[model samples]
Target: MIKVGIVGGTGYTGVELLRLLAQHPEANVDVITSRSEAGQAVADMYPNLRGHYDLRFTEPDADRLAACDVVFFATPHGVAHSLAGEILDKGGRVIDLSADFRIRDPELWAKWYGQPHGAPELLKEAVYGLPEVNREKIKQARLIAAPGCYPTAVQLATIPLLEAGLVSADDIIADCKSGVSGAGRGASVGSLLCESSESMMAYAVAGHRHLPEIQQGLEEAAQSDVGLTFVPHLTPMIRGIHATVYTQLLDDAEVDLQTLFEKRYANEPFVDVMPAGSHPATRSVKGVNMCRISIHRPQNGKRVVVLSVIDNLVKGASGQAIQNMNLMFGLPEATGLNQVALMP
Candidate 1:
């Protein structure tokens, strides 16, 4: 069994790791850390994990964590910046579900995250954990930087077009919507049920932190700098992200887009490219680690639209983290992550 240790095991992503790892036949999650919740039983905090984990939360200790085969940092940005190296030094692979090492340029990361990059040195080798794009790299990676919820949906929705050069990368727009859970398990006025229910408002219109990350992935795919306008909206729901992406089709691009998207993700275990006229629903992927995508071109015009959906906390966070762990350890990529999506 692959012994696993988790840092910051109190947030949504943290418990998510616990929930998913519970079903991971080859994984044994023995250590879960939380400075504030130390000594608290994992079951008491999350009833869903009551029958599975008998462990209690403990304060983080690099030596103890490094004893595990792999360490998952479910903490926010900068938390892993301090301890990941120690665990890596102790010979444990690290997969961070934060924005810490996702951005290649440290200065750009600092500019957006409001703090200097803590572990820029590790950036040199940290592989971006999008299995569709970096599967080979992840197998050899000691440090994996998992993409954020929004970036995952947006990039998957647009990258195929960008890579084929069938779309004009000079202008792209992603009008995305996400559940309140995307805000995390924290107490915030914005995430309050009364405040969020019966309302939908777009935030970070000027620019979202995810903008640069999305652009980076698309640019890498297109092999050119991409011009993108991204707008994120907070919805009344609790657990998914729906990304509606728009782009301009190149004048000579007359290939069958449905086949293109289908072929692009045919071998990918998690990305589902729906039928030509399908409009994937976020609920279709709720609680599952899958991205349901569909392609559209209004009136056969030059405009193309891509609709993608994912469970933010799963495919967008912990599920993807586990997926990377599977790759790094040579386990099947879908191990412990084949749960069927929960429906209403």
Candidate 2:
């Protein structure tokens, strides 16, 4: 079995990791760390994991973490960098679900994150972990920087258009909405039930941290700089992200948008290309590592609309992290990620 350790196992992504790892045939949870919740039974805090995991939370210790074959950093952005180098030095691979190593430019990362990067030198070595785009690279990487929730949904929806040169890359617009869980497990007035429920509003319109990450991925796919207007909204739900993407078609030719999406994701195990004229709903992908997409060209106009949906906590975070781990360990890409989406 591949021994696994998780740092910061108290947040939404952290528990989601535990929920998935509990059933992984080749994975064993060796340690779970939390600064504030150390010494508490993981099941005590998360009753859903009671029968699956009998482990207790511990403080983040490099030595103990390095002993495992791989470590997953589910902590906030800055926490992973401080401990990743030591784990790597001790011959352990790392999968970080934070923004610490996602962006290539350390200066840009520092500017958005509001602090100096803890390990700028390691940025060059950390591979961006989006299985659909970087599957081969992930198999050989020792450090994997998983994509953020918003970027995961937006990029999957629009990358094919950019790659095929079917759309104008300069005028791409991604209007995305996410559940309150995207804010994290922390308490805030903005995330309160009274504040979010029955009310929908956009935040981070001026600039969201995920904007640069999304642009970076799209630009790489298009082989040129892309101009994207990414705006994120907070919905009343608890989990999922719905991204409505708009792009202008370069030619008025009769192009099969459905075929384009289906062919692109034909071999991908996680991306679901829905039927033509279908609108994918966020709940359809909840609690699973799946990105369901639907493509449309209204009134046969030059504009194309792509709707993408994913569980913000699963496909958007922990589930994708485990997918990268499976690739890194030479296991089947779907080894532990084959769970069907949970239904009501």
After superposing candidate 2 on the true structure, give the runs of residues whose Cα lies further than 4 Å from its correct spot: 252-254
Stretches off by above 4 angstroms in model 1 are none
Candidate 1 TM-score over all chains jointly: 0.99
Question: lDDT for model 1, on a 0 to 1 scale?
Answer: 0.95
Give candidate 2's TM-score.
Answer: 0.99
Over 1-344, each residue of candidate 2 has an lDDT whose tens digit, in order, gives 99999999999999999999998999999999999998999999999998998899999999999999999999888988879999999999999999999999999999999999999989989999999999999999999999999999999999999888888889999999999999999999999999999999999999999999999999999999899999999999999999999999986546788999999999999999999999999989988999999999999899999999999998899999999999998999898888877777
lDDT of each: 0.95, 0.94
Per-model root-mean-square deviation over C-alphas: 0.6, 0.9
**Model 2 poorest 10 in a row by lDDT:** 249-258
Model 2's C-alpha root-mean-square deviation from the true structure amounts to 0.9
The number of clashing residue pairs in model 2 is 0
* Residue range 1-344, candidate 1, lDDT tens digits: 99999999999999999999999999999899999999999999999987898999999999999999999999988999979998998888899999999999999999999999999999998999999999999999999999999999999999999989999989999999999999999899999989999999999999899999998999999999899999999999999999999999998998899999999999999999998999999999999999999999999899999999999999999999999999999999999999999878
